[model samples]
Target: MQRRQFVIALTGLFAAHRIAEAAVNPTDPIKIEKLVLSDAEWKKRLAPEAYQVLRHEGTERAGTSPLNAEKRKGYFACAGCDLPLFLSETKYESGTGWPSFYNFIPGRMETKTDFKLILPRTEYHCARCEGHQGHVFDDGPKPTGKRYCNNGVALKFVPA
Candidate 1:
């Protein structure tokens, strides 16, 4: 029947769309200017949680990061590379139980599509070290409708 054929075509189109969404590449291989360490070195350099989050692109549990409560003026840097990723002024209470930021230091991050959760997300990482920081979402405060949801273990706060 025409109805059955139409249904099949629609399903095929939906599948193609999902594939395209997941096809966004993470990062291209290039010579990095900043530090590049082997897996063993990273395991030794970072704490267990930091290594998991930064190196393996793992997310910490919600409401667990002390940075969620951080209110002082400071910079948030990558735990693996110490590259300044965000400023104190950009930090906001997103109520997502994580250290959410409205924006990041320009030129310090690179974004790629992540299909880990089945839905595609714009995941960003440290441009210098290629360490996974977190994903950026559209739901955020004014000026920039981007919420850079970061894992606390992936960053180190430096008080100014």
Candidate 2:
């Protein structure tokens, strides 16, 4: 009984430590230093398509992203600043012809209302570089009913 009690106490301590770590949110843009760069610098650092998507808020054609077919274990990070945005496990086939995710890494993205399409949409960007990644919608599977439709050109996959 004492041993079980000790184990429970240790588990509680571990859980508390993890919760504290989560509270800090290392990727939170307000807390972490943001990466700012000039247009020329960004152009030089990224491909033409990546620049259009990440810097100019351009969307790639639907069904055109190779990342849509990606199935290996990896992280989809911002092509502009290499910030991990989505985990492989969170990825799903939303049939939106994009690399879709059910969730994103906490604090790695920020959202703003966009009206470019004549309708309001929740567009999200990378917290580190403020690069455009994609938009989030309410249509998604369980646990979190949010579909983050992302532009493939704006991301680079990193194997875990």
User: Which ten contiguous residues of candidate 1 have the minimum total lDDT?
Assistant: 22-31
lDDT (Cα, tens digit) per residue for candidate 2, span 1-160: 6985676556556544543453354234334336666698789989999999999999999999999999998778788876677889999999999999999988789899999999999999988689999999999987899999999999988765
User: What lDDT score goes with residue 48 in model 2?
Assistant: 98
For residue 153, model 2's alpha carbon misses the true position, in angstroms, by 0.5
Clashing pairs in 1: none
Model 1 gets an lDDT of 0.80
Query: Against the true structure, whose lDDT is highest?
Result: 2
- Candidate 1 regions with alpha-carbon error over 4 angstroms: 1-32
How close is every model to the real structure, measured as TM-score? 0.79, 0.80
Q: Clashes in model 2: which pairs? A: none
Q: Report how far off residue 113 is in candidate 1 (Å).
A: 0.3
**Model 2 score (lDDT):** 0.83
As a TM-score, model 2 comes out at 0.80
- Tens digits of per-residue lDDT for model 1, 69-124: 99897788788866677888899999998899999877779999999999999999
